[model samples]
Target: MRPVASVSFDDLLRAHQGMIRAFLRRLCRNDALADDLAQDAFLIAHQRLGDLRDTGAAKSWLFQIAYNVYAGHARKHARRRELFEAQNGADLDDAAQPAPAGMARDIAMAMDQLPADVRACVLMCLSYGMSHSEASKASGLPLGTVKSHIKRGTEKLRAFLHAYQQA
Candidate 1:
Protein backbone atom coordinates (compact mmCIF):
# COMPACT_ATOMS: atom_id res chain seq x y z
CA MET A 1 0.00 0.00 0.00
CA ARG A 2 1.09 3.58 -0.66
CA PRO A 3 2.19 5.70 2.28
CA VAL A 4 -0.45 7.95 3.87
CA ALA A 5 2.02 10.85 3.56
CA SER A 6 1.71 10.49 -0.17
CA VAL A 7 -1.97 11.53 0.18
CA SER A 8 -3.01 15.16 0.53
CA PHE A 9 -2.96 16.24 4.18
CA ASP A 10 -5.93 18.50 3.45
CA ASP A 11 -7.99 15.46 2.49
CA LEU A 12 -7.16 13.85 5.83
CA LEU A 13 -8.11 17.06 7.61
CA ARG A 14 -11.44 17.28 5.81
CA ALA A 15 -12.27 13.68 6.61
CA HIS A 16 -11.41 13.57 10.30
CA GLN A 17 -11.85 17.19 11.42
CA GLY A 18 -15.25 16.82 13.11
CA MET A 19 -14.24 13.75 15.08
CA ILE A 20 -11.07 15.46 16.31
CA ARG A 21 -12.98 18.59 17.38
CA ALA A 22 -15.59 16.60 19.27
CA PHE A 23 -12.93 14.49 20.99
CA LEU A 24 -11.00 17.61 22.01
CA ARG A 25 -14.15 19.38 23.18
CA ARG A 26 -14.98 16.53 25.51
CA LEU A 27 -11.42 16.47 26.83
CA CYS A 28 -10.92 20.26 27.24
CA ARG A 29 -14.54 21.36 27.87
CA ASN A 30 -13.78 24.57 25.98
CA ASP A 31 -14.75 25.10 22.36
CA ALA A 32 -11.91 27.48 21.55
CA LEU A 33 -9.34 25.21 23.10
CA ALA A 34 -10.88 22.27 21.31
CA ASP A 35 -10.60 24.08 17.99
CA ASP A 36 -6.97 24.89 18.65
CA LEU A 37 -6.26 21.30 19.67
CA ALA A 38 -8.03 19.98 16.61
CA GLN A 39 -5.78 22.07 14.36
CA ASP A 40 -2.75 20.90 16.27
CA ALA A 41 -3.91 17.29 16.00
CA PHE A 42 -4.24 17.54 12.23
CA LEU A 43 -0.82 19.09 11.96
CA ILE A 44 0.68 16.35 14.07
CA ALA A 45 -1.15 13.71 12.09
CA HIS A 46 0.15 15.18 8.84
CA GLN A 47 3.68 15.22 10.16
CA ARG A 48 3.43 11.61 11.31
CA LEU A 49 1.37 10.28 8.42
CA GLY A 50 4.08 7.86 7.32
CA ASP A 51 3.90 6.17 10.70
CA LEU A 52 0.25 5.28 10.25
CA ARG A 53 0.02 1.64 9.26
CA ASP A 54 -3.59 0.96 8.52
CA THR A 55 -5.67 3.47 6.59
CA GLY A 56 -8.75 1.96 8.21
CA ALA A 57 -7.32 2.71 11.64
CA ALA A 58 -6.39 6.30 10.81
CA LYS A 59 -9.47 7.78 12.47
CA SER A 60 -8.91 5.99 15.76
CA TRP A 61 -5.17 6.69 15.59
CA LEU A 62 -5.83 10.39 15.05
CA PHE A 63 -8.20 10.42 18.00
CA GLN A 64 -5.58 8.72 20.18
CA ILE A 65 -3.05 11.42 19.33
CA ALA A 66 -5.62 14.13 20.06
CA TYR A 67 -6.42 12.52 23.40
CA ASN A 68 -2.75 12.50 24.38
CA VAL A 69 -2.38 16.17 23.42
CA TYR A 70 -5.45 17.17 25.45
CA ALA A 71 -4.31 15.16 28.47
CA GLY A 72 -0.89 16.84 28.41
CA HIS A 73 -2.48 20.26 28.04
CA ALA A 74 -4.84 19.59 30.94
CA ARG A 75 -2.00 18.50 33.20
CA LYS A 76 0.09 21.55 32.32
CA HIS A 77 -2.85 23.91 32.87
CA ALA A 78 -3.66 22.25 36.17
CA ARG A 79 -0.13 22.87 37.41
CA ARG A 80 -0.37 26.45 36.23
CA ARG A 81 -3.64 26.87 38.11
CA GLU A 82 -2.05 25.57 41.26
CA LEU A 83 0.83 27.97 40.92
CA PHE A 84 -1.51 30.88 40.26
CA GLU A 85 -3.64 30.03 43.26
CA ALA A 86 -0.56 29.79 45.48
CA GLN A 87 0.72 33.15 44.27
CA ASN A 88 -2.61 34.99 44.54
CA GLY A 89 -4.04 33.16 47.59
CA ALA A 90 -7.37 33.22 45.76
CA ASP A 91 -9.16 30.43 43.98
CA LEU A 92 -9.89 31.07 40.33
CA ASP A 93 -12.94 29.43 38.86
CA ASP A 94 -11.82 29.40 35.28
CA ALA A 95 -14.37 26.69 34.56
CA ALA A 96 -17.31 28.37 36.21
CA GLN A 97 -20.38 28.85 34.05
CA PRO A 98 -24.09 29.39 34.51
CA ALA A 99 -25.58 26.05 35.39
CA PRO A 100 -27.85 24.63 32.76
CA ALA A 101 -31.31 23.40 33.60
CA GLY A 102 -32.45 20.16 35.10
CA MET A 103 -30.36 17.01 35.49
CA ALA A 104 -27.88 17.40 32.64
CA ARG A 105 -25.65 20.00 34.23
CA ASP A 106 -25.75 18.20 37.54
CA ILE A 107 -24.68 15.03 35.81
CA ALA A 108 -21.91 16.85 33.97
CA MET A 109 -20.67 18.45 37.17
CA ALA A 110 -20.59 15.06 38.81
CA MET A 111 -18.66 13.68 35.87
CA ASP A 112 -16.22 16.56 36.20
CA GLN A 113 -15.43 15.41 39.71
CA LEU A 114 -14.31 12.04 38.40
CA PRO A 115 -10.70 11.13 37.65
CA ALA A 116 -9.73 12.01 34.10
CA ASP A 117 -9.60 8.45 32.81
CA VAL A 118 -12.94 7.59 34.33
CA ARG A 119 -14.47 10.80 33.02
CA ALA A 120 -13.15 10.12 29.53
CA CYS A 121 -14.66 6.63 29.55
CA VAL A 122 -17.98 7.96 30.80
CA LEU A 123 -18.13 10.73 28.23
CA MET A 124 -17.12 8.49 25.35
CA CYS A 125 -19.73 5.91 26.28
CA LEU A 126 -22.61 8.15 27.34
CA SER A 127 -22.21 11.48 25.55
CA TYR A 128 -20.74 10.26 22.30
CA GLY A 129 -22.64 6.96 22.12
CA MET A 130 -19.56 4.80 21.86
CA SER A 131 -19.73 1.14 22.80
CA HIS A 132 -17.53 -0.16 25.58
CA SER A 133 -15.15 -1.77 23.12
CA GLU A 134 -14.99 1.36 21.02
CA ALA A 135 -14.42 3.48 24.10
CA SER A 136 -11.74 1.07 25.23
CA LYS A 137 -9.92 1.44 21.93
CA ALA A 138 -10.38 5.20 21.87
CA SER A 139 -9.27 5.58 25.48
CA GLY A 140 -6.55 2.94 25.45
CA LEU A 141 -8.25 1.23 28.36
CA PRO A 142 -9.44 -2.33 28.67
CA LEU A 143 -13.04 -3.04 27.78
CA GLY A 144 -13.81 -4.22 31.29
CA THR A 145 -12.35 -1.04 32.71
CA VAL A 146 -14.39 1.03 30.33
CA LYS A 147 -17.55 -0.79 31.39
CA SER A 148 -16.71 -0.36 35.05
CA HIS A 149 -16.04 3.33 34.67
CA ILE A 150 -19.33 3.85 32.82
CA LYS A 151 -21.28 1.94 35.44
CA ARG A 152 -19.68 3.75 38.35
CA GLY A 153 -19.79 7.09 36.63
CA THR A 154 -23.50 6.69 35.90
CA GLU A 155 -24.22 5.74 39.48
CA LYS A 156 -22.29 8.71 40.76
CA LEU A 157 -24.02 11.09 38.38
CA ARG A 158 -27.42 9.80 39.43
CA ALA A 159 -26.58 10.15 43.08
CA PHE A 160 -25.30 13.67 42.52
CA LEU A 161 -28.45 14.68 40.66
CA HIS A 162 -30.60 13.21 43.39
CA ALA A 163 -28.72 15.19 45.99
CA TYR A 164 -29.03 18.35 43.91
CA GLN A 165 -32.77 17.87 43.61
CA GLN A 166 -33.04 17.41 47.38
CA ALA A 167 -31.16 20.65 47.84
Candidate 2:
Protein backbone atom coordinates (compact mmCIF):
# COMPACT_ATOMS: atom_id res chain seq x y z
CA MET A 1 0.00 0.00 0.00
CA ARG A 2 1.20 3.48 -0.76
CA PRO A 3 1.88 5.73 2.14
CA VAL A 4 -0.38 8.79 2.41
CA ALA A 5 2.60 10.91 1.53
CA SER A 6 2.46 9.46 -1.97
CA VAL A 7 -0.87 11.12 -2.64
CA SER A 8 -1.03 14.85 -2.29
CA PHE A 9 -3.62 16.21 0.12
CA ASP A 10 -4.94 18.53 -2.57
CA ASP A 11 -5.73 15.55 -4.78
CA LEU A 12 -7.52 13.86 -1.94
CA LEU A 13 -9.52 16.97 -1.17
CA ARG A 14 -10.56 17.42 -4.79
CA ALA A 15 -11.64 13.83 -5.14
CA HIS A 16 -13.55 13.49 -1.89
CA GLN A 17 -14.84 16.95 -1.07
CA GLY A 18 -18.25 16.61 -2.72
CA MET A 19 -18.94 13.19 -1.25
CA ILE A 20 -17.79 14.28 2.17
CA ARG A 21 -19.94 17.38 2.08
CA ALA A 22 -22.93 15.39 0.92
CA PHE A 23 -22.46 12.94 3.74
CA LEU A 24 -22.24 15.78 6.22
CA ARG A 25 -25.30 17.45 4.72
CA ARG A 26 -27.35 14.32 5.10
CA LEU A 27 -26.18 13.90 8.67
CA CYS A 28 -26.74 17.49 9.74
CA ARG A 29 -29.63 18.16 7.35
CA ASN A 30 -28.31 21.63 6.68
CA ASP A 31 -26.40 22.66 3.59
CA ALA A 32 -24.55 25.63 5.07
CA LEU A 33 -23.64 23.84 8.25
CA ALA A 34 -22.52 20.83 6.27
CA ASP A 35 -20.24 23.01 4.16
CA ASP A 36 -18.72 24.50 7.31
CA LEU A 37 -18.24 21.07 8.87
CA ALA A 38 -16.76 19.65 5.69
CA GLN A 39 -14.24 22.49 5.59
CA ASP A 40 -13.38 21.87 9.22
CA ALA A 41 -12.99 18.14 8.58
CA PHE A 42 -10.69 18.73 5.61
CA LEU A 43 -8.67 21.20 7.63
CA ILE A 44 -8.22 18.62 10.35
CA ALA A 45 -7.42 15.92 7.82
CA HIS A 46 -4.77 18.11 6.26
CA GLN A 47 -3.32 18.79 9.69
CA ARG A 48 -3.18 15.06 10.45
CA LEU A 49 -2.14 13.79 7.02
CA GLY A 50 1.01 12.36 8.45
CA ASP A 51 -0.98 10.03 10.64
CA LEU A 52 -2.75 8.31 7.74
CA ARG A 53 -1.08 4.95 7.20
CA ASP A 54 -2.24 4.26 3.65
CA THR A 55 -3.20 6.46 0.76
CA GLY A 56 -5.65 3.82 -0.44
CA ALA A 57 -7.63 4.21 2.76
CA ALA A 58 -7.81 7.98 2.61
CA LYS A 59 -11.55 8.12 1.91
CA SER A 60 -12.42 6.12 4.96
CA TRP A 61 -9.92 8.01 7.05
CA LEU A 62 -11.36 11.33 5.94
CA PHE A 63 -14.84 10.05 6.65
CA GLN A 64 -13.81 9.00 10.11
CA ILE A 65 -12.43 12.46 10.73
CA ALA A 66 -15.55 14.10 9.36
CA TYR A 67 -17.80 11.98 11.53
CA ASN A 68 -15.74 12.79 14.59
CA VAL A 69 -15.83 16.47 13.75
CA TYR A 70 -19.60 16.36 13.43
CA ALA A 71 -19.90 14.44 16.65
CA GLY A 72 -17.79 17.00 18.44
CA HIS A 73 -19.94 19.82 17.15
CA ALA A 74 -23.05 17.98 18.26
CA ARG A 75 -21.70 17.43 21.73
CA LYS A 76 -20.50 20.99 22.08
CA HIS A 77 -23.84 22.38 20.99
CA ALA A 78 -26.13 19.96 22.76
CA ARG A 79 -27.53 22.56 25.12
CA ARG A 80 -27.91 25.11 22.38
CA ARG A 81 -29.73 22.56 20.26
CA GLU A 82 -32.09 21.88 23.13
CA LEU A 83 -32.79 25.55 23.57
CA PHE A 84 -33.42 25.98 19.84
CA GLU A 85 -35.76 23.02 19.87
CA ALA A 86 -37.59 24.34 22.86
CA GLN A 87 -38.08 27.73 21.29
CA ASN A 88 -38.94 26.45 17.83
CA GLY A 89 -40.86 23.37 18.88
CA ALA A 90 -38.82 21.41 16.36
CA ASP A 91 -35.58 19.57 15.92
CA LEU A 92 -32.70 21.03 13.98
CA ASP A 93 -33.69 18.96 10.98
CA ASP A 94 -36.83 21.02 10.75
CA ALA A 95 -34.73 24.11 10.55
CA ALA A 96 -32.57 22.73 7.77
CA GLN A 97 -32.70 23.87 4.18
CA PRO A 98 -35.89 23.09 2.32
CA ALA A 99 -35.97 19.45 1.37
CA PRO A 100 -36.83 18.13 -2.06
CA ALA A 101 -40.18 16.58 -2.86
CA GLY A 102 -41.51 13.01 -3.16
CA MET A 103 -39.12 10.21 -2.28
CA ALA A 104 -36.33 12.60 -1.40
CA ARG A 105 -38.53 14.26 1.16
CA ASP A 106 -39.70 10.92 2.51
CA ILE A 107 -36.18 9.63 2.75
CA ALA A 108 -34.98 12.73 4.56
CA MET A 109 -37.84 12.46 7.02
CA ALA A 110 -37.12 8.80 7.64
CA MET A 111 -33.45 9.51 8.08
CA ASP A 112 -34.33 12.16 10.60
CA GLN A 113 -36.06 9.49 12.65
CA LEU A 114 -32.82 7.58 13.04
CA PRO A 115 -30.42 8.16 15.90
CA ALA A 116 -27.38 10.19 14.85
CA ASP A 117 -24.99 7.26 14.95
CA VAL A 118 -27.39 5.06 13.02
CA ARG A 119 -28.00 7.83 10.54
CA ALA A 120 -24.27 8.31 10.07
CA CYS A 121 -23.82 4.61 9.46
CA VAL A 122 -26.68 4.51 6.98
CA LEU A 123 -25.47 7.54 5.06
CA MET A 124 -21.93 6.26 4.88
CA CYS A 125 -23.08 2.92 3.51
CA LEU A 126 -26.06 3.71 1.33
CA SER A 127 -25.53 7.30 0.34
CA TYR A 128 -21.78 7.18 -0.12
CA GLY A 129 -21.53 3.51 -1.14
CA MET A 130 -19.08 2.63 1.57
CA SER A 131 -18.78 -1.03 2.49
CA HIS A 132 -19.94 -2.13 5.92
CA SER A 133 -16.40 -2.44 7.17
CA GLU A 134 -15.48 0.94 5.71
CA ALA A 135 -18.53 2.47 7.34
CA SER A 136 -17.67 0.77 10.61
CA LYS A 137 -14.23 2.29 10.50
CA ALA A 138 -15.52 5.70 9.42
CA SER A 139 -18.20 5.81 12.10
CA GLY A 140 -16.12 4.20 14.83
CA LEU A 141 -18.96 1.74 15.17
CA PRO A 142 -18.41 -1.94 15.66
CA LEU A 143 -18.75 -3.84 12.41
CA GLY A 144 -21.85 -5.62 13.63
CA THR A 145 -23.33 -2.35 14.78
CA VAL A 146 -22.71 -0.76 11.40
CA LYS A 147 -24.36 -3.72 9.70
CA SER A 148 -27.30 -3.53 12.09
CA HIS A 149 -27.70 0.19 11.59
CA ILE A 150 -27.75 -0.20 7.82
CA LYS A 151 -30.30 -2.98 8.01
CA ARG A 152 -32.59 -1.20 10.43
CA GLY A 153 -32.16 2.16 8.78
CA THR A 154 -32.97 0.63 5.40
CA GLU A 155 -36.04 -1.01 6.85
CA LYS A 156 -37.23 2.25 8.33
CA LEU A 157 -36.73 4.10 5.04
CA ARG A 158 -38.48 1.38 3.13
CA ALA A 159 -41.42 1.47 5.51
CA PHE A 160 -41.63 5.22 5.38
CA LEU A 161 -41.49 5.27 1.60
CA HIS A 162 -43.80 2.31 1.13
CA ALA A 163 -46.46 4.55 -0.33
CA TYR A 164 -44.11 5.59 -3.10
CA GLN A 165 -43.49 1.96 -3.83
CA GLN A 166 -47.22 1.43 -4.30
CA ALA A 167 -47.49 4.47 -6.46
Most TM-score-accurate candidate: 2
Runs in model 2 with CA error above 4 Å? none
| lDDT (Cα, 0-100) at 136 in candidate 1 | 81
lDDT of 1 by residue, 14-116 (tens): 8879877876765566677788878887888878987787666676677777877877777778877688899987534335334567676766566668877
Q: Write the per-residue lDDT of candidate 2 for residues 1-167, one digit (tens) a residue.
A: 88555788899899999999988888888888999999999999989988888988898999999999999999998899899989988777457678689767777777888998999998888877889999998888899999988899889888777866887
The residue ranges of model 1 lying beyond 4 angstroms of the native Cα positions read 1-8, 86-104, 160-167
Model 2 steric clash pairs: none
Full-model lDDT for every candidate: 0.74, 0.88
lDDT of 1: 0.74
> What are the clashing pairs of model 1?
none
RMSD to the hidden true structure, all candidates: 4.0, 1.5
lDDT of 1 at 141: 83
